[model samples]
Target: MDDETSSHIDDTDRRTLVNAQGAVQVVRTTSESVDTRLQQLLDRANQQETEMTDVADAVSELSATIEEIAASAEQVENRSQTAAARAEEGDEAARQATERMDNIHGQMSDVRTELQSLLDRIDEIESALSGITRIAEQTNMLALNASIEAARADNSDGFAVVADEIEALAAESQEYADEIDAVLSDLRSAADSTDSELDAALVEVEQSSDEVERALDKLGAVADAIEETATDVTAVSEATDEQARVSQSVMDRCTTAAERATEMTTTVDAIDQFRAEQTAMLEEIDDALTEATPALSVTDIDRIPTGLDPLDEATDGGLLLGGQSVIQHDSPVVDVVATLCASALSAGYAVSVTPPEAMSRQDLSEGLASHGSSLSDALATDRLFVLDMFDEWTSERNIFDMRASSLADVNRETATRRDKPLLIVGNIAGEIALLGEEQARQARYENDSTVFNPADTVCNVVDERTVDESFGAFYAGAADQVLELTGDGPNRELTLRSSPTGSAPPRPLPATSTPVSPRGD
Candidate 1:
């Protein structure tokens, strides 16, 4: 408006107009700058809101993960608690078992010691019984000799009393011995049963120990798994922590889960230790049982003969002969007669049997063959003599006479021939007894050699069923050595009764030594 005042007045008005226009332009520029700055602030606030939303979403995911981890941690904590309880129970059970085993071992040790003592006592008892038996036998022999002397001196009352006392003592001793033997047998049976029971117990313990060992192995595996899980959980927790620095909420739950897994591993380890200890204890028990099985052999086998050497050692040293032996029979003595006849024939000695009718010749031959002697060799040796009394007798009286005469001839011939051993067998003991004592004594001698009296060689044979006081009297008076051959369990056993050298009264003749044949040679 002012161009120069029209020019001056006009100038003043123009200046005012120009100044107002400048102020207005300055206002418009300031307003535009403020509008641009406000628009920028709004855009930045929007970006900040988006970032806030993303953080919120991330926090939400972290919270969910933390909840899941919390649940897992709780489950792991429960499992660890359960495992801890189980481990405690296992430890308690193992401790109880160990205590029980200790008690069992103590009891077993005491039992073993007691058993050893009992075995020693039994051995002592057995030895005492044997000694008693020997004493009884000696007493019996003494009683028998005393009876003979009393009868000869006509002291009947003394003889009866002495005999009664001796018989009673012998019976008592035998009863005691039998009782001891029975007790020993029972002890042996008990020992065998105990051994069987111990073996079964050992087997059961071994199986239990194996099962416990397997359980321990499984627990160890579980512990290893838990450890691996804990390691993985720790790694996850660390990654979550780094993420939480960028975002914040997930690391805490991962750390808690790792701690729970570690706790579960500790419980498993405790259980494994308990099982391992139990297994070790069972192994020790098994070892102890295995060590205790060899000292029970007292009454299991028979006592072998004392004087005889081993069969292999005695191959060159044959059986010794020349003892007065009697073979008594109920019907006919088959085994004893055959054995003696075979032995004599094999020894290359002239052998004679008085009653050939009593035995089978074929049986004799076969028996000889069984004893390593050929039947042909025995027959060809011309050493076996058979006196057939049946052919020599015409009547019953003659039969008796013939038997008596033949026995006398056999005795006389055997006594006269020192080089030959005689095996005289008779079917009837009555026939031999019928001969007068003087005649019998004479018949028992060959020339000046007496072979059927105590001072020489004597033997008495009487049937067991018919053996009585009279038989005993005859046996006591006539024999130096009397043997009763009896059948017992697939064998023929000989029971010997003899007089001691200085105990009885002196005899009419001096002792005569019979010739003996060497073995194998």
Candidate 2:
């Protein structure tokens, strides 16, 4: 072969090799971008599952509240109905009393008429007595004249005797008239007294009748009001019942959605696994390409901040990437965990392990929100992962149903899933409650060997009030860093008791370190 031909062939082979390397680089870049998008999709699916589960729970709570309202409304309706019936009865009774009073008033009027008639008869008797007296006087005068005539006629004895007898008869008639006049005056006085009494009785009866009529009117109004109230209560009860039914239906649908979301999450997991395999293949291809070219550079940070300035300063930038930390606190552990999670997530991905009942998702979300981040968004972006550990007593999927040691593996895998530094915060007291003290101690011992990865930064919180001295001491002794929280509310303090490098100093906690209440509160 000629020298020019060999040189030309070599240049052609070099150009082809250069083109292949460029294509490999472009493919690797594209694969990385695709991998990131797939990861985001998987995270969104997981977030949807969590949201669906929360919706189901909220709906159930609403249904229960609706049922309680319905029950209260029913009670109100029953009491109002009883009151309405009693009011009606009282109205009827008042009407009967009013009728009786009217009858009494009529009877009293009749009596008054009779009394007036008696008064008239007494006055007539008085006139008759006056006439009798006048007649008596005239008769006496006639007798006296007869006596005088007898005296003048001398020897008329029989006529004089007859005149005397007539005078005596007139005297007796005057005496009887005077007696009748006295009796009539007494009768008239009694009639007047009786008539006055009847007038007073009639006034009282009329007053009572008026009062009874007013009372009947008031009773009728009360009955109507009570009936309306009962009807309104019945309507409220029925509405509450309907609301309960609707809430129950909503809960059922939410449960179904949650189940479907779970299935979707499972599918996402499969996709993620497939993506991992693809990533591995891409990485292999890149490794081979690197042999023919310069390798890409990557910078790794060994520590992450704990969000608390003093804590970060004390721990020399926070927690070591591959070390375990123990936090023993007299104050609420939830706040400390929140602070740690918020800070760690600022740098990289984070995994929080806690019991389902220890701290609600809303509380955690609010904690994140306080740091100017959204929990749902973080979760959907795969920057934050929450693992709920439920005990046998809890209604959630119990972690205790599996081997206690398996939780360490699960936590480790979750912490190491991403290439980024991960912070794992757990509540030791909650774990103890799930798996008794002895089992928890054993698990803790096992966790040291299996739970941590080289890139994992783990913080375990222990409530001083919940665990014994020995248990807390053991955890402290095993951890690379030991932090203690003291005091309460705004006065709370975070102090590093032990450090792997022994450089971090104690610092005052912020006023916001006060307990983060649940979302509902």
Candidate 3:
């Protein structure tokens, strides 16, 4: 039992041990294989984890880039909105500019239309002015032709009136004449009557001058005879007076009586001689006056031309053609006459005036200048002559005698000098009569050729007191002309009225044509 039992037991134990060892080894091998596989799995899991971390870093970089892109897109959207707003503003401004341009164009069109209308109106005005100018020219031409025809007919009255009208027309034309041809027409009218009037006047004056020459010779003989008789009478008276003185006492008385008788006889003889001489002078003066009468005829007056209508009408188309004597009284009537005479001279009359003391020379000069004449030119023409009567008269007898003598002498002289009219003025009532009535009448009647009555042609110069009323009355009267020169407030008017009958008015005298002031060139 023992050995076999030991061996069997051992075997049994060995078998049990081997089986248990084999089972344990197999379980250990399975666990190690599982641990290696788990390690490999863990290593793979770690690699996966590393891969996951790298992926996460890459994802963060991509997210930051996406955020930057979003910001850029927002900025671009804002810029686009700003651009759209600016474009809308620019379009609105353009529309407003177009509207302003349309308004300006409309204003320009209206201005153009107004300018065209103004041009049309200017053309119409120019046409009207042209028509008026043409009418004025034609009127002037007609006046000129009429004046020329009248002058050729040798009708002085017609010539003077027509010439005056023509001159007025010419003056009117001067304001509008644009050429020399129109001025030539005026000159032709002025020249037409000069030669015809001068020739006729010259012929009449020549005939009268011859008659004056004969009268002068006869008067000279009478004067010499009167002087011789007076000398003889004086000698006889002296002889008788000497004889009376020689005889003394009673004889002296007888001698004185004889001497007185002789002196009386001598006085009577001298008076007779003076009377004869005066008669002879009167006869001579009458002859001279008679010869001068024809030269002063209206025919002579008609041949001359006067350029002024007022002057020609006042003087019956001429000046004092009939060698008439005009008397002027105090009241500036003399001044009126002087103005008339001056106007006559300007119209080509040769005038002579004897001014009284009452006439104002300064007023006369100013009056002439106012009539559109330079004082120097009026004086230099020798057309007007003035005699101061105040300077000529010495005594009362001298005044009467001088007036008579001067009238006779002037009448004779004027007959010789012709070519223009003459005016003689005298202060007839101013002188006192030295001779008796019969003697004075004889002196006046014999010496003077033309006698004028004061009532018929006397012009009273109105004083300040009754100037307005007197002037109105005078103007209404039937005189050849009325001249009213007065200072009325701030105005001065020279009114002239023509006589109802076309005859020259009575002119007192010509005034001295003295220069009032210096002349301008």
Give model 3 RMSD, 1 decimal. 87.9
What's the candidate order when arranged by decreasing lDDT? 2, 1, 3
lDDT of 1 by residue, 368-398 (tens): 6655675555434544545444554233211
| Native-to-model Cα distance after best TM-score fit, residue 487 in candidate 3, in Å | 13
Give a tens-digit lDDT track for model 2, residues 1-521.
11121111112233234334434554555566667877798788889889989999999998998899899999999999889889988998998999899999999899889888888887787788788899999999999999999998978899999999999999999999988988888888888888888899999999999999999989988998999899899999999998898899999999999898899888878877887787788678756654654321112335666778778778767776556678888776566676667666655555555633456665666667777777777765656766555532322221222334356666555545544555667767667776777776676545544554445556778788877654665566445578998887677888998764674556898855424754311
Report every candidate's CA lDDT: 0.46, 0.70, 0.42
What is candidate 3's lDDT per residue for 318-349, written digit by digit as tens?
A: 32232222221223344455565456555554
| Model 1 CA deviation exceeding 4 Å by range | 1-55, 199-521
> How much does candidate 1 score in TM-score?
0.34
Which has the better lDDT: candidate 2, or candidate 3? 2
With a 3 Å backbone cut-off (N, CA, C), the pairs that clash in candidate 3 are: 156-302, 331-461
TM-score winner between candidates 1 and 2: 2
What 10-residue stretch in candidate 3 is worst by lDDT?
1-10
